[model samples]
Target: MESSLVLEKYAEKNRFYREITEKILSGKTLNFEEALRLYQEGDFYFLGTLANVVKENLHQKRYYYTINRHINYTNVCTTNCKFCGYHKKPGEKGGYTYQVEEIIETLKSTPELKEVHIVGGVNPELPYEYYVELIRKVRENFPSLRIRAFTCVEIDWLSKISKKPVEEVLTELKQAGLNSLPGGGAEVFSERLHKELYPKKIGYQRWLEIAKTAHRLGIPTNATLLFGHLETDEEIINHLLTLREAQEETKGFYCFIPLAFIPEGNELSYLPGPSALKILKTIAISRIILSNFPHIKAYWVFLGVKLAQIALLWGADHFHGTVIEEKISQSMRKDTVVHLSKEEIERLIQEIGGEPVEI
Candidate 1:
């Protein structure tokens, strides 16, 4: 089979991507080449149309969102990742750690917020107990508020510092008021990409281990993948497969968030960000690939209001809600909005022909 002929035969047989589109529509997974071609060929307009069929089939016009606040406990990290612009230097003026009392005070200040997402750079001065104490105090302050804090990297850090297994650290954290783990720091699971792009970050296995442990401990978790950096098509699929396999094992992932790499003052300033079309394709692929997980979330923070509104047609069942304070974006994101108001989210969904969910 000649190379061009093989590719041509696929296009001819599919004939307007009917076969591939149906494969996705029928709830089947698309491989590396198929997923990449969706991005490479400039055909997302049609792809988004097809993906909406799945979205409507699975989720009609209903959209899911939450009232959440993202708090950065500390910005000091041991791993000075290359693509990070938010981490302060060791002697940097703004580098400071929040005590449990300070964090409780911050939580007390916000009355409407029910969920708190606490994650930041890996801190050296604060040991695992600091996190435990923080979670306990936050819970003590607001017993009803759900704490969606910590990342896989932080889990691995706790494992090392406390000299305990990952499961033990997670158990301790959970007992102290940790509700669940947020899906961050999952840039790309490709080892080659990981070594090249973020050498200071945790390894792929460590991340999987932490999520798996959290699931075993009966903690619900959210997973994410960062595209548009230095990952190949096969690498992207591999990242998805890693996530899918973990979900299959634990059945704990609540949402699959496909976050775009917003290149601003980011360390990877030279890298081009994913286009609107690519972002849509990624959302569609996430919906098609992550069959184990029930929800596919479209994070409006990095994608901005316009693209996120359009993404509803691309199998995005959940429109991520207003993040009261999002430093993660300003750290490396280009499209940084403090908080997309409820009114803004509602209008966007209405524009997309989807209804905003009250929850």
Candidate 2:
């Protein structure tokens, strides 16, 4: 259907939605207040339709996925964020760290792997050489593979451990064949939430500094937001806008991923996680706000396969990847699968009338 006809059909009854729809159709960027209003008051279906329009304008129904493997190198973390269930305190039982060779062997076992995602806890025990060696060996063995490793949080920890500036640390890692940084640990950009939820982790300014540094050095990274916790609507929109401002400067963020908060085994388990409607609304709002971003991911690991599929039409273009193993979410929800086959991924995208583009 034409954009005007679609808008007329779904949004014409409400002037607020109709005006917003017209503004989106005309290619005008939404201000922070406009985005917050759309997220707070616009009809859910109207939001989805308008977000899909913006998505189609950019990607034209191409849904991206990757044949990637996630390797959580260690679970012994010192930064004990209340929302996390994956970390073990230092020297705690069940805390495990992978040797460089073990990671290589795991890669050897998987066939047709295009990318290797490596992330883990802030282990003070491991020397800085461990990280460099891990990256160097992975690059040596899988010369063609893409290595997306470490979050800004982990990078900050590495800087402290190595006694090197973040720039030097990222330079050494990039030289050792780190392809990009994953978007984790950037739960929310609000200082209130930072102090309340994850006081040990790096604050938003430092996180953006590290990310912008990576961008300046020619390394692309993804951005993420962890919602459904103790964040208000204004805080969420501000987070997206802050990222948008950063992207305007660096253009380094390759994708924006809205991660649904999973409140299962964490300290905040008493609070129920975000509902499906909340998830879809956030994803759509993320697409509308982060115009500088090229892709929005409905990370299937947290959203579950079905909702992630629905998210494709609601403004998400990335179905994440065939994550061979993801220990973080699995630690919280026992039923979370460690892997999804390529056939299954393709079928899910096809069922939603999306063409899967393997990255």
Q: Of the candidates shown, which would achieve the greatest lDDT relative to the real structure?
A: 2
lDDT of 2 at 108: 99
Per-prediction count of colliding residue pairs?
0, 0
lDDT of 2 by residue, 122-181 (tens): 999999999999999999999999999999999999999999999999999999999999
Could you tell me the TM-score of candidate 2?
0.98
Q: Compared to the true structure, candidate 1 yields what TM-score?
A: 0.90
Q: What is the TM-score of each candidate against the true structure?
A: 0.90, 0.98
List clashing residue pairs in candidate 2: none
Candidate 1: 10-residue stretch with minimal lDDT = 1-10
Q: How many backbone clashes are present in model 1?
A: 0
